[model samples]
Target: MDEKVLLGHGSGGTMMRRIIDEVFFDAYGGEELAAGNDAADLPLPAEGERLAYSTDSFVVTPHFFPGGDIGHLAVCGTVNDVATSGAAPKYLSCGFILEEGFPMEDLKRICQSMADVAKEAGVRIVTGDTKVVNRGHGDGVYINTSGVGFIPAGRVLGGQYCKPGDKVLVSGTLGDHGITIMSCREELSFRADLKSDAAPLNHLIAEVLEAAPHTRCFRDPTRGGLASTLNELAEQSGVDMVVDEMNVPVKDAVRGACEMLGYDVFQVANEGKMVCVVPAEESELALEAMRANEYGTDAAIIGEVLPCPDDRSPRVSIRTGFGSMRILDMLVGEQLPRIC
Candidate 1:
């Protein structure tokens, strides 16, 4: 590891994992922290009660984008993390670090956006804190959100729970959020309409869980995108994954943007999408449930888990559009920075 942290350490790829394992985890190792799920599952004070808790910070540049803004990202990110554990997100705490002299009007708008999203997700922002940093010491605004949710009885989910015969599914198209941010950041113009796919997925997740109670795992392909996310799940579950390229949805506009920018759609961020692993028999039910939600209309079964090969090393392989297979590894470095 390097003596100083680099942006790659936060890229949610190999470097990030190394830092977590060698630095943070080394210093703060524990059963809860070591589990390495999107959120921490904790035993509640009341018997038979369990809670999922997670925290996330947003530093997206521009703050405002096509379909959503930083405030929306902050609320949805934390809410999705808690909900990924099969919990119903209930409450959130927000903390803001504002640059001195920042415009008050923009701040108000951001807060209202957060309020609206929280209400939509059926979660409440019950607590928060505010801090002002020197004019040059901070971005326009940065938001940190911590959320807690109640887990249903006898419901268990995590990457490690995935089995060889489980099916893999994604809620909708990949890379919309990442490409939208890139185009906005670089001020690129395109004939095709481009927008961020940023939305809260708690409601959609609830529906899927209701229909596919045997869901083995749930993950939001955010920072490092679907490739890193699926790789993590495969390694954790000690299984292999074979994904079909044609089945992984990608909008024409997003594909065009990626081609123009040399971005790999599989490795781009998506704020409003999720990957669900469930028993093969229940895949149809899961897909049907997801499609019933607005956020998951393009839902599809993209892949299937396979037993590890002779070497017993977990791996992810994608069948390319050209009908060739290739291993998908984590991104070597950050492709787009300051992207939520």
Candidate 2:
């Protein structure tokens, strides 16, 4: 029989220690978890007055998807969230909810991924907990991550900071993560050459901020994808926004898949990509910064914020290659559930 998780593993006794030592600690160890304390003792940023803290949970179905698994998504999701605020992520806490009989080997794989990704992003998995539920009561594994970083003084970024003349940019191709998840589902099994764009983007965002200090904001288009992200920003700033459909960078394979699946490419979720808004003059600077990073080679300026004409409510519009215009709106209902 395959070695599998058992409820006893979470009993906080010898079995729990075995799981923590043989699985989690063996995969990733640091000062925090090694201390064996109830909570991690952390230090404050040396200089920055503002701190960025974010938390998120991952429960994507088919946890093992192309290009990324739940472990990668869990770490990247929280790290990216902190980085979007122009902070360099420093620490992370991960919690796992695992099902009984879940393969121990698979758990090891996920834990190792979390370690490797956290290392690359320069963030430490400082603390964590593991719990196993009875069979059929929980998914194979669900990860929750919380991250923290320090934002330098005088740095302010948010959807509300958007201004007309600010240029909108994306780190790379869109729809890769969403399409990959959809294609790999057993029921559909839609074949495509797509992989989840899940990645840690702290370094990439750092580079962008370095090149363009006047950046208005950064947002990861995860759940609602590009359309919803832009619309949210437009509404926040009370500014209309416009984009040329052709300017958005999307992989041909993803586009083809979306066409076949009757999905709007703009509304698909992404894991590793970020949408940046910068002042017009700093647009090229930001784009160049993104291109310099491995994760942002395909970065492009996709659109610009516009003054709301006649003081109308903020809205986002896209100009098609065919010369027609359409309002870009947030997804009303679920469009691909359980997609990270």
Candidate 3:
């Protein structure tokens, strides 16, 4: 534990447990995790509900960033994904792929961050696996997380559930995560501040579900951003989506960076925000609930779903402020490779 570690630390025996107990549980120990069971066996609320699950891997470069790191990213990313399904995220499983020469101090810091994030989200890392690859073959670290949550009996949400006249809402400003990482990596200096929008969204989702059960679907625009996520939902639901470029929120600093780097904000990634589709009647309620939360203070309605242009194929279109419209599609290639 002095410095960097070797492959043996990931053998799933004493070394691994030592790492877990000494660095992880030792810092975040509480009654919920003291038992050291293979998996957590906690009871759920008495309400009849079905479960929602999601998993994701984080390989963000520079490990740490202005607002988050791979450890927090691993927990918050999966929690947001599960929450987007309109369910209450409850438990998590974390798997680590570490490099042989990775620093033990960094590992401990990461685990501590993970533990804190799990506590904040009210989700426990009940089970996990770890492995080590040769220094040259692997990146510094990679984390894969699986999450499970229970969707209450009357809750309904999905990409395919969208119908014409359904309104689209965004939780907050866009492209913060992508811009922050790029700035940190390229060492670019800017007059305005830019930080990653990385945080757990389950609490906001809970409020939305409570206020707007008519919401048809929820999507976190991660790797592909808002444009790609909308295209995905359009295709899945066989509907067309129309978004107003003026209505979508983007911070001035993030917008400046995107313009300078020739990066399309619509295709940039986000960690803390989400896109919600809801019946027109519930759009106001959803917006109010999202705006009341810290993560979504700038929430706004950006678009609506309509009948697909071609029978069953869904398409996404954007309306620019200049009085013209254009089709928006999935991103062709990576805007910023190695970006989480």
Q: Which candidate is the best by TM-score?
A: 2
Instruction: Kindly list the per-residue Cα lDDT of model 3 for residues 214-284, writing each as its tens digit.
Output: 88889999899998999999888888999999999999999989999999899999999989999999999
**Alpha-carbon lDDT, every model:** 0.86, 0.91, 0.88
Per-residue lDDT for 169-236 in model 2, tens only? 99999999998999888445455467899999999998999999999999999999999999999989
Q: What does the lDDT come to for candidate 2?
A: 0.91
Q: Per-residue lDDT tens digits of candidate 1, residues 1-340?
A: 5543344544558876775566434433355557766655654545665889999999999899999999999999999999999888987877777776666557667777887888799987655555657667888789999999988778899989989989999999999999989988888886238888899999999999989989998999999999999999999988999999999999998998889889999999999999999999999999999999999999999999999987758999999889999999987799999889
TM-score of each: 0.86, 0.97, 0.95
Candidate 2: clashing residue pairs, number? 0
TM-score of 3: 0.95
Deviating ranges (above 4 Å) for candidate 1: 1-46, 310-312
Error of 1 at 107 (Å): 0.3
lDDT ranking from best to worst?
A: 2, 3, 1
Candidate 2 clash pair list: none
List runs of model 2 lying over 4 Å from the truth.
Answer: 186-192
Which scores greater on TM-score, model 1 or model 3?
Answer: 3
* Shift in Å, residue 219, candidate 3: 0.7
